[model samples]
Target chain A: MELLEEKIRKEGQVKGEGILKVDSFLNHQLDVALFEEMGKAFAKRFAGEGVNKILTIESSGIAIATSTARYFDYCPVVFGKKYVSLNLDQEIYSSDVYSYTKQQAYKIMVSKKYLDKDDRILIIDDFLANGKAVEALIDMVNQAGATLVGVGIAIEKGFQDGGALLREQGIALESLAIVDAMSEEEGVIFRAQSEKK
Target chain B: MELLEEKIRKEGQVKGEGILKVDSFLNHQLDVALFEEMGKAFAKRFAGEGVNKILTIESSGIAIATSTARYFDYCPVVFGKKYVSLNLDQEIYSSDVYSYTKQQAYKIMVSKKYLDKDDRILIIDDFLANGKAVEALIDMVNQAGATLVGVGIAIEKGFQDGGALLREQGIALESLAIVDAMSEEEGVIFRAQSEKK
Candidate 1:
C-alpha cells in the first residue's frame, strides 16, 4: 500500500475537485510490477477465504483481476462484459450499473456457465468511486448463489460512499490506496491506511 | 502452445461454422496459470526484441497483456480505450476498427503520453480473425512512431486472412493456436503448428 500511495503521490494528477487521474500508471498505462505487489497484498489480506474465482467488470478491471488471480492459487478470473457481444452467450446473469464518470447507464453481464453456488468469488477492480460497478458484480454473484469472499480494489475514492457502504454491509473491502479528499489547488489527500486494519 | 491448443480442443465450443468459443479459459473466465504459460511462450518467441511495452485493447486483451509484461522485465502494459471518457487526455492516437463478430465499428484510443518513438511495443490480443482490430493497433503504433516488434495472438482463425495478411506484410506475427477449419458438426480442426515455423 505504501508503494501504491507513493506512486499516486508522485504521478497522480488531480483534476477539479473529485477526479484523480492516474492514467500514467494505474489505468490506461499499467505497471504490472505494482499490480503484482497489489496482488500479493490482496492474497495476504484474504488468506484463508477459499477464493476459487475472481469477478470483475470489463475494461479496467480485467488487468487487476488477472493479476490478483495468480496469487489465489491461480483462480479463474471471470470479467463482466459491458457490451453484449454476439459471442457472449444469451444465458447470462445481467445487472444494470450507472457510471458517474462516464455519466451513462450500462448493463454488465457474466455467463451463467462461469459462476454457481459452489464457487467462492472475490471481486477485483482498478478504481472504486460510487461503487456502482462493484455493486453490479455483487448482484451477479448473488444471482448465481455464489458466496463473495471479499472485494479487492487498487484505489478507493473514500470521499465517495461506495467503500463505506460495503464496509457498513459487513463486506470485507480492501483498497490499497484510499483518497479521502482531492482538489486542483490542494492536490489529493489520502486517508491513512492504518485506520482500516 | 500445446497446452493452449489442448484447452481449446477440450473446452472450446465450436458454434456454427466459424465461431469457436473458448470463453471458459481465455476470454470470460481466465485461467491465470495458462496465461503465465502463454506469457512465457511469448517471451521465448520475442526474446531479443527488446520490447519495453505491451500494447492491447481494453476488456479481453488487458489480461494477456498484463500476463505477458512480466516476462518482458515487467514492461508497461498500455491498453487502448474503446470508449473515451472525460478523464482521458485530449491528445490521443486514435484508429478505427471494424469488429466482424460484433458487427460494429469503434474507435480505439491510446494516450500520447504512454507510447513514443523509442518504445518497442508488442500487441497482444485474444483472437485474430479479419485482423481489423490488429490493423487498427498497428496504425496507432505507426502514428506514435513506435516500433511494433510483433503481434501475439492467443487464437488465430486461419480460415480468415488476418494471420495470412500480417505474414504477407512481413510482420512478425505469432499465434499460439491456429484453427484452420471448424464446424459444429465436425468440431474444430487446427492447422499443424509445425507448419508455421
Candidate 2:
C-alpha cells in the first residue's frame, strides 16, 4: 500500500475536476510488479473469505484483477463488459451502471457460466470514484446468487461519496491507496495509513 | 502450450463464422495461472530480445499483457485504447483499425509519453484473427519510433490470413496454439507444433 501511494505521489498527475491521470503506471501503462504487491495486500485483507472468483469491470480493471487472481490461488477473474445496450441474454448476468464522467448510463454483463451460487466473489477495480461501477459489479454477484466476499480497489477517491457509500453498506472494501484530496498545484493528499479500510 | 490447447479443446466454444470462443480462460473469465504459464512460454520464445516493455490493446489483451510483463522482469505494459473517433491529441499516437466482427472501423491510441525510440516492445494479444488490431498497434509503434521485438499471441486462427501475413513480413511471431481448422462437430484441429512460426 505504501509503495502504491508512493508511486501515485511520484507519477500521478492531478488535473482539474478531480481527474487523476496515472497513465504512466496505473491505467494506460501497467506496472505488474506493483500489481503483484497490491494483489498480496488484497489477499491479506480478505484472507479467509473463500474467494473463488475475482470480478471487475473492464477496460482498466482487467490488469489489476488478473494480477490479484494469482494470490487467490489463481481464481478465475471475471470482468463485466461495457455495452451501451445489451441483448439481455438469459445466459448472462447484467447490471446497469450510471457513469458520472460520461453523464450516461450503460450496462455491464458477465456470462452466467462464470459466476454462480457456489462462488465467492471479490470485486476489484482500478478506481472507485462515485462507486457506480462497483455497485454494478455487486449487482451482478447478487444476480448470480453468489456470495459477495468483499471489494478490492487500486485507488479510491476518498473525497468522493463512493468509499463512504460502500462502507455504509457494510462491504469489506480495501483500497490500496485512498486519495483524500488532490489538486493541480498542491498535488495529491493521501489518507493516513491508519485510516484505510 | 499443451495446457492452453487442452483448455481450448475442452472449454472453447465453436460458434458460427469461424468464431472460437475461449472466454472461459483467455479473455472474459481470465485464468491467471494459465496466463503465467503463457508468460513463461513467451519469455522462453522471445528470450534475449531485451523486451523491456509489453504493448497490447485494451479489454482482452490487458490481462495477458500484464501477466506476460511479469516474465519480462516486470516491465511496463502499455495498452492501446479503442475509441470511435479520437481527438488526435498531440500527446498520443493513433492508428485506425477496421474490425470485421463489428463491420466498423475504430481508432486505437497510445500515449506518446509511454512509447518512444529507445523502448523494446513485445506486443501481446488474446487473439490474432485478421491481425488488423496487431497491425494497427505496430503502426503506433512505428509512429513512436519504437523497436518491436516481436508479437506473442495466445491463439492464432491459422485459417485466417493474419498469421501468414505477419510471418511473411519476417516478424518474430509466436502463437501458443494455432488452430488450423475447427468446427462444432470436429472441434479444433491445431497445426502441428513443429509447423508453427
Candidate 3:
C-alpha cells in the first residue's frame, strides 16, 4: 500500500474537479510488478474469506482483478461486460449503471452461467469514485445468489461517498490508495493510512 | 499450449457463424491459473526479443496482456482505450477499427506518453478472427515509431485471414491455440499443433 501511495504521489497528476490521473502506472499503462504488490496486500487483508471469484467492470478493472486473482488462489475473474456484442449470451444478470465520466447510463452484465450461487465473490476495480460501478456489480452478485466476500480497489476517491457508504454498510472494502482530496494547483491528498498490514 | 487446447475442447462453446465462446476461461470468467501457463508459453516463444512492453486493447485483452507481461519480466502493459470519456488525454495516437462482433466502427487510442520509439512491444490479445483489432494496434505502434517484436494470440481462428496475413508479412505470430474449424453440433477443432515448445 505504501508503494502504491508513493507511486501515486510521484506520478499522479491532479486535475481540476477531483481528477487524479495515474494512467502512467494504474489504468491505461499498467505496471504489473506494482500490481503484484497490490495483490499481495489485498490477499493479506482478505485472507481466509474463501473468495473463489473476482467480479469487475470491463476496460480498466480487468488487469488489476486479474493480478489480484493470482493472490487469491488463482480465482476466476468475471468482468462485467459493458458493450453488448453479437456473441454475448441471452441469459445474463444485467444491471444499469450511471457513469459520471461518460455523463450517461449504460448496462453492465455478466453471463448467468459464470456467476453461480456457490461463488464467493470479491468485487475488484481500479477506481471507486461514486460507487455506482461497485453497486452494479453487487447487484449482479445478488441476482446470481452469490455471496460477496468483500471489495478490493486499487484507488478509491475517499472524498466521495462511495467508500464511506460501503464501510457503513459493513462491507470490507480495501483500497490500496485512497485520495481524500486533490486540486490542479495543489496535489493529491491521500487519506490517513488505514490499511491493515 | 496443450492445456489451452484442452480447455477449449472441454469448456468452449461452439456458436453459430464461427463463434467459439471460451468465456469460461479466456475472456469473461478468466482462469488466472491457465493464464499463468499461457504467460510461460508466450515467454518461451517470444524470448530474447527484448520486449520491454506489452500492448493490448481494453476489457478482454487487458487480463491476457497482464498475465503475459509477468512472463516478459513484468513489462509494462499498455492497453488501447476504445471508449473515450471525460478524462482521456488529448495527446494520443488513434486508429480506426471495425468490429465484426458489434458490426460497427470504433476508434482505439493510446496515450502518447506511454508508448515510445525505444519500446519493443509484443501485441497480446484474446482472439484473432479478422485481425482488425491487432492491425489497429500495429498501426498505433507504427504511429509512435515503436518496434513491434511480434504478436501473441490466445486463440486465433486459423480459418480466418487474420493470422495468415500477419504471418505472410513475416511477423513472428505465436497463437496458443488456433481453431481450424468448429460447429454447433461437432464442437471445436483446433488447428494442427503448430506451437513451438
Candidate 3, CAPRI quality class derived from DockQ: high
Higher-scoring candidate on lDDT, 1 or 3: 1
Model 2 clash number: 0
Native contacts, share recovered per candidate: 0.99, 0.80, 0.99
Residue-level lDDT of model 1, residues B62-175, one tens digit each, is: 999999999999999999999789999999999999987888899999999999999999999999999999999999999999999999999999999999999999999989
Best candidate, TM-score-wise?
A: 1
- lDDT for A194 in candidate 2 is 91
DockQ for every model comes to: 0.94, 0.62, 0.89
> Largest lDDT belongs to which candidate?
1
Kindly give the number of clashing pairs for every candidate. Answer: 0, 0, 0
- lDDT, model 1, position B194: 81
Chain B, per-candidate TM-score: 0.98, 0.96, 0.97
Per-residue CA lDDT of candidate 3, range B1-197, in tens? 79999998889999898888888888888999998899899999889989999999987899999998998889999999997867889999999999987899999999999899999999999999999999999999999999999999999998899998999898999999988888999988777774421
In CAPRI terms, where does candidate 1 land?
A: high
> Residue B128's C-alpha lDDT in candidate 2?
95
| Cα shift from native, residue A40, model 1 (Å) | 0.4
